[model samples]
Target: MYRRTRRAVVTSLLVSSVVCGGAVVLAPAAGAAVPAASCTVTPGPNDTYVTISGEGFTGPRKLNDGESTVDLAIGPDGTFLVKRFQKNVDYTVLAVNEDQNFIFVNCKKVGTAATPKPENPQNTAPAQPGSRRDIAQGRAAGNQAGTAAAAKSCTTKPVADKSGQQHSDAYWQAWTQAANRSFNRACHTN
Candidate 1:
């Protein structure tokens, strides 16, 4: 009976043991439901900095953050494993080199799928630049600037005194005044 109990205990202890370099690790059970896969990014060619982070994962996974260089595992299949992360969140390189290298994200979810709300309005694509939707929504990158520039463009340009005729003082003065008026209308400048 004692031997049976000992064997039971030993078997229970071996439930989650992972052997690495003659060491044993008792990993936590995922509690019946399988966890989600994670997104990962490596520094592409000419990338001076890179990182990844998201739900169900630990601290920031980074290659650099302007503080110091990071030792990144850049294998075709990286050799490190932490807790899993969720899928479909923007993975950005928070703070990176002055010149940014385009980041490419690749991941596969191996477990339960992420459920998104049906017909979510905010899930629609953002307004196109300079489109009516962008201007109305105040999301146009040049909304205010474009309006101000249009105001300037609407006024007719000043006619220069390039008619090589010798003009009297009164004629030159009147021409200057007309030019100033056009300038005021165009730029709202006195």
Candidate 2:
């Protein structure tokens, strides 16, 4: 009996409040929609490599390489680049943002063949002999090129401390480590 009376009182109060314009309603603000994420896969120099670029990812994101589905962090400018990704092998890049919005980019032409072709297809045009030393030098040059690209991508502004003062040595050390990690990821040096 007590429970029934309490329920009736609560219902009457709610109805009266609404009728007397005492009720408050909430609504979402207009134009608060988030921008959509997008991604692209493009062929790199001489079709030897592929690059996966993404934009509009506003937060930490995951990259699904189709096969491996590894999670990769996106950059601060709502963009990320996977440079020098090897070509001649099928790859579907999927970028998923924190909100679960995703965009898939297919590298159909870049790596469609089951059996990969040679990196240099100028077999008929050139028969120039090369020594082991030349091969080593070529590898070194390629590494340097990759490092250069990674350096460009890894450049970042120094972060101010929470108190808006100069950062401590420990903070700088952590920042440098993070930058190094980003460089390694971009250049595949690690």
Candidate 3:
């Protein structure tokens, strides 16, 4: 005699557990199916700033270079820009986007991979007290301070002098001189 039997079996993986830094994280049973998020890396002026733009991201986002990380300010449209990003030499940047349900990782290389050597090692000496570099830095600082002072002193914006429907070189020169005088007085006066 032969007897037939039926059985019910559950074979789906309900949840997955991952151990991270002595912490156990239970994965979600199910989530919405979506395409992986990505970002574009663009090197800015002298490779000092890096602009990252993309879409379709949620939750937190950041840029990492293994040792340090910078948080990205994501807009409502999912685009981000990293102004004044300090690029590391010989390193790959890791762009991360973390949502409640998933984590997206993207790797990119920014700036020169090799360390740049000074063209003239002798000329790479530190800036002296009255050196050109020092003067430039001082001038920059003074310009910023003076500009703020001038702006605060003036009730309205300074307008450049112009001829009838046209501006001459002399007029521009005079205008610049006046502005320089104003700034110099504001910054250098005791």
Specify the highest-lDDT model's number: 2
Off by over 4 Å in 2: 1-31, 88-98, 103-190
User: How well does each candidate superpose onto the true structure, as a TM-score?
Assistant: 0.17, 0.35, 0.34
lDDT for each residue of candidate 1 in 56-104, tens digit (9 for 90 to 100)? 2222233322222233333333233322122223232211211212121
Q: Using TM-score as the measure, what is the rank order of every candidate, best first? A: 2, 3, 1
Clashing pairs in 1: none
Per-residue lDDT of 1-190 in model 2, one digit per residue for the tens? 4335434443554465567775422222356565656666667645667777777665455444423445656778778778646544444434332123433334334333544554655433422225343344334434454455576665442232345434344444444455455457775666
Per-residue error (Å), model 2, residue 187: 58
Off by over 4 Å in 3: 1-17, 20-33, 89-102, 109-190
Winner of 2 and 3 under TM-score: 2
In candidate 1 the C-alpha lDDT for residue 153 amounts to 73
Most accurate candidate by TM-score? 2
Give model 2's TM-score versus the native structure.
0.35
Measured with C-alpha atoms, the lDDT of residue 72 in candidate 1 is 36
Each model's number of backbone clashes? 0, 0, 0
Which candidate would rank higher by lDDT, 2 or 3? Answer: 2
